[model samples]
Target: MPLYFYSTREPYGEFSNFALYGVKIDGEWWPTTEHYFQAQKFEDAAYRRKIRDAHSPKLAADLGRSRRVPLRPNWESVKDDVMRACVLKKFETHSDLRELLLSTGDEEIVENAPGDYYWGIGKDGSGKNMLGKILEEVRAKLKNAAC
Candidate 1:
């Protein structure tokens, strides 16, 4: 089974009823997608800032608005580290994130963005599914740490 989420109130596609942000987990509202995204940003501050700063003002603004960072080519290898950084910051402060992840019970959690080949399993389910894989790994790490 695949766990699903969408940032907005009206969930997208198959997640249409599984909205992420406002859902309650562990008696608390779940953190927004931006919360996770912002936390992940700290994982590679220098690189993210360098790219944003080096770009033209318009591009920089666009990047900020899009919240999309230019990552290292070996991002897949470092993705777990990024997720770990996010989990460390949010696990205690945002219990909802932690509890929700734990509740997945070994199922893959997919972001399900139709066009996001890197972070999502595409509509046809042909994409790399990197983000889902990272989430599972992070969940396992957290579970082990709790042991």
Candidate 2:
């Protein structure tokens, strides 16, 4: 699956257009300033916007503020720098993501997409990661086969 980074408002109730870092499908970086995307940097925003917009047909709610690491330390509103969310199609190919964007818009795409993140945690806190467990199991199986 291709990982994409999208820029939305840093925090909810903030300016729409702001210069912030984002990620692209091809491991590219995207930055935005206020409501518009930083063109001099990477103008794929137009393409993304178009794709996201096209998904409005099955959309349930209006576009909401995008999410990213917390900038401010608002104890009431913002608690942690990393927000943990669960993307309930955790596995989808690049074409799947594109289809989702075009068919359901950004909101719906995100809604149906599967993902999650963790806040502040230490070494001991580093529990089982999905990919990590898979790799470990594969390694063990290979060792057993060799034996």
Candidate 3:
């Protein structure tokens, strides 16, 4: 059966970007993958830092969802790559998370966000689920690297 994940409080919660795993990328520490992913939507360095330093992932998400700061022109095309890098780095930085992800043994991963049709399975299950697909890709990479 597929592994369904969404809320940070649920089973397999670590798989959610909102989970408390921090990742260091480009010499800076992000509080969570959600912060980093959200911050990447903008081109302003200061705005990005604001999102990065936000007290919580929910706040960072709120900042990211704001259209006050225009998004990078290529955000649409580069978002998946950004998420992939963040997820990979998060798992790489945390050994316990790596093991937990690998222990799933190839079960399909799904981000069960009812309102996010792009990165999750929407209410009707017709969403693209890009985040889940990225997690599976990262899982495969980690499995191969253990060889």
Candidate 4:
């Protein structure tokens, strides 16, 4: 069976970007993968900082989705890589999260986000679930490193 995750209150919630896992990247600490991923959408350092310092992941996402500040032209091309890096760093930083991810043992991970079709399974379950794919990729990398 696939592992479905969405809210931070549910099982496998740790896999969600909204989970409370802080990662240090580029000499700065991000409160969660959501914060890091959202902030990277822009080239503007000040704007990035604003997203990074958001009080919560949801607020950071809101800021990221805002078009007020133009996204970096390369955002679409590089978003997956950025998410991969953030997820990898997050799992790498927290041993408990690593163990929990590995415990799934090759199960297909799905982000059960009804509203987000790209990073999750949409309402009809046809969404791309890119976040789940990224987690699985990170799981494989961590598993291999442990061998």
- Per lDDT, the best of the predicted structures is 3
Q: How many residue pairs clash in each candidate?
A: 0, 10, 0, 0
The list of candidate 1 runs beyond 4 A from truth reads 10-61, 64-80
State, as a TM-score between 0 and 1, how close model 4 is to the true structure.
0.99
Task: List CA RMSD, all candidates.
Answer: 8.3, 17.4, 0.5, 0.5
Show the colliding residue pairs in model 1: none
Candidate 2 Cα RMSD after full superposition onto the native fold (Å):
17.4
TM-score of each: 0.54, 0.18, 0.99, 0.99
Candidate 4 residues 1-147, lDDT tens each? 999999999999999999999999989999999999999999999999999999999999999999999999999999999999999999999999999999999999999999989999999999999999999999999999999
lDDT against the true structure, per candidate, is 0.51, 0.25, 0.97, 0.96
Candidate 4 off by > 4 Å: none
lDDT of 1 by residue, 68-134 (tens): 5544466557655654444344444446667767777878778776876766767787777666676
Off by over 4 Å in 2: 1-128
lDDT at position 50, candidate 3: 100
lDDT of 1 at 63: 44
Quality of model 1 by C-alpha lDDT: 0.51
Please give the ranking of all candidate structures by lDDT, highest first, separated by commas.
Answer: 3, 4, 1, 2
Candidate 2 local lDDT, 8-125, one digit each (tens): 3222111112212222423432232211121212234554453234333112012222223222234334322111111111112223322333332222111111232221112343
